[model samples]
Target: MLLSRLTGVSVLGLALLLGACSSTPEKEKVAEQPAAELYKESQIRMEDGNYRSAIAHLEALLSRYPFGPHADQAQLDLISAYYASADNPAALASIDRFIRLNPTHKDIDYALYMRGLVNEDEDRNYFQELFRIDRSDRDPHNIREAFGDYERLLREYPGSKYAPDAALRMTALKNRLARYEVQVAEYYYARDAFVASLGRGKYVLEYMPDTPEVERALELMALCYEELGMEKAQQDTLRVLKLNYPDNEMVLTVGS
Candidate 1:
């Protein structure tokens, strides 16, 4: 009986040792791999749309080979992986770090383009579209940031391959920002807050003058002026609206 108890104790000790050995975690084991192999694996994962795995591999590669020949590309790939996984903060951080570290790199323009693209796509997601929340009332902060990013890209790299697309995106973002102002104006008008509506309308006109929302902004300003008993301002806005948008639907409403 004494020998059997001793044997049981020995088996238990062996079992515990094995359990501890096996519990080291799969990721730690992977960390032992070479950076080149890890980076190549990350590229494959990214191509397969396995962004989480790609991010993991790229992070491992960067940790292992901070100054490797593939370091810059790895950092750029990590940014794209983060963006693909909807990890905007991580993507932004990665892009910023790359730009800071390699300001004069040949691919710096691509980094700037990705920065703008990241901001541009940040507010465009499946859930937002599904709920229709973005179309009606969007936070203009992201749009404005994206616009600024694109502007910087164009200013710094005027002949960049991405300049054309960046320009197009800026135009769309401008309209969206103008539309946000229009939405705010409409909300104020609905609440009988004519002064606030006028302020928002004037902002849209001053900042986003050539946008389609300008007509609505002008109409809102005129209505607010009429509501506030400012007949001179109302007449002046109506004249400008009539001059710019001869067939404006709001012309009839403001005319009366």
Candidate 2:
């Protein structure tokens, strides 16, 4: 009986030892380097086009030292890294968060510029691009979104370093929008929807007068007026088209 009790005690002790070992939690692998070191490593990775690794390092550094001196810059770098990695949705979210969190940040202009670029990149059409199709008939929703982003950036930071490039992009966007309007006018005219075509053409002439598509819009308006028996309006539109595009084939044909 004594021997059996001793054996039972030994088995219980072994079980307790195994239980204690199992219950002991493993230590987390601590980061040995400082946040600054991690940030530098991320920068190097980004410069070398290792954006994924750069993002990982930046994320780790931010988590470890959320309030460090490099936190804000790290956040900015993270956005750039995400963009470079083509993680556009994450980049956009990060940019918006940064803007909201640091409204008066010195680099807000850059953030806005980057936001515009990201939105614009998302607006590209694959088939249209591959086929070299005219953009006039393409969906303008994303284009409009990008245009709004750039417009807000310009309005908020007129003197920003990125203002000039944003201005150029805005001009291109306007021309595209104007062309889309002209295309719609042409489509309506093709379908004998004279009033609708005239309205769309007039909208372009009034709001997008400076665009190259203005000539086409005017031509469309003239054609619609001619078809609708508005002789006076048709003559007036033809004169305006002749004044702007004196050698235009449509003007020569329609004017005669």
Candidate 3:
């Protein structure tokens, strides 16, 4: 019985010594990893729409080897992840970081486009909320930032692979914003703010020629001028409307 206990103790001591000797180096086991592997895995997760898992690996890779060969790719994927996860602030930050670090990258146009995505077409829901809650309005800053990024992609990287997509999105966004302007003009018109209505209507006609509201905008301008009893302006707005829409019958007066 004593011999058996002695043998067991000897085996246990040897096993403990081996465990101590074979422990992985702290850095190698945890924080350090092959950059290419982590990046590839992150990309795979992103392509599969597993954005949260992708972000986990990307954040780890970036923390450890930020300047590695996959840094730029990881940074872009991080932005996508935040967007997918609906974390707008993080998405903005990631795109900003990518832009600042990779201004000269061949696909920098993509980064610019992404920044636009984070701020692009301002949804009416958010706008209405801001107007309701904030007397101090900072929402316009985000709109302008998004617009500027799209404009930058157009100007600096016109021939980029992403330029076509960016241009399409930019046009769509511009049209939506113009529609907002028309809404304001209609509001003023309804309130009998004749001068403001005329000015806003003219802007829609002159600046945004492609919107569906252009015809109605001219009609509003004519009404405003006639209400203010400006004969020449009334005639001119009617003339412009008839010229633009030759076949459509126009009502020149409120009751008619």
Candidate 4:
């Protein structure tokens, strides 16, 4: 009787081990899934907002079948998945890779647009959002890169469906850049660095004309000129400011 009981326990343990081996973890099973199936699974995960899982599946599909029917779509979806997961670096890398490898891909314009968005969001500060802090004075390197990306999209893909939206974003980016210059001018002026302040103010007027910040730039230049004791230059700046913004407080107080 004892021998028979031991034999039954051993057989049960063997079956349990086999079951564990056959039931591979879902993530591990990704490697064995067919390319089309993997892509479909990724799409499902993406729809469900499971970006991390989608990323894994898309990446697997791309690796296993680089030249498969779904390769192109997988790459594009991977970029989106990375972005949705807040993985900016990975998103950028994937975008650059797509642009380089498939320059003539019908979806190239979409890749460019995604690249611009990733760069634009790269510098987004949670603190700024939470506190409503103005970030116009912050370093705008990423912002400039994003602006250039959109500019290239407009220049190269003029008729792309993304052109209209890109144009709008470009306008906003230009204004932000203009505001950055204005902030720098204000910083210099506060430190009594009138010459530097004047130079930055001129930059906005010359290169960033038509922006909403132009008036502020003009007022700042007028103040810089006044501080530097350049009466004629100050008068000229005030004349322009008054002509454009007659009701401006600076025009009222200083021009008067």
- Using lDDT as the measure, the top candidate is 4
The lDDT, on a scale of 0 to 1, for candidate 1 is: 0.83
lDDT of 2 by residue, 155-232 (tens): 999999889989999999889889888888888899999999999999998988899999888888888988999999
The Cα error of candidate 1 at residue 110, in Å, is 1.8
Give the lowest summed-lDDT range of ten residues in model 4. Answer: 1-10
Model 3, CA-based lDDT: 0.73
Among these predicted structures, which one has the highest TM-score? 4
Ranking by TM-score: 4, 1, 2, 3
- What TM-score would every model get versus the actual structure? 0.82, 0.81, 0.74, 0.86
- Report lDDT per candidate: 0.83, 0.83, 0.73, 0.86
What lDDT, from 0 to 1, does candidate 2 have? 0.83
Give the lDDT of residue 72 in candidate 3: 78
Clashing pairs in 3: none
Better model by lDDT, 3 or 4? Answer: 4
The candidate, 1 or 4, that scores higher on TM-score is 4
Which tens-of-lDDT digit does each residue in 1-256 have in candidate 3? 0101112335567677568658533322224569988888888887887777788889999988978888877887788787776567888888887778777887788788878877752332332343465322233455667767888999999888867877787676666656666777788999999899889888888887887778888888888988999988888878877777765467433323
Q: Over all chains combined, what TM-score does candidate 3 have?
A: 0.74
Error of 2 at 226 (Å): 1.8
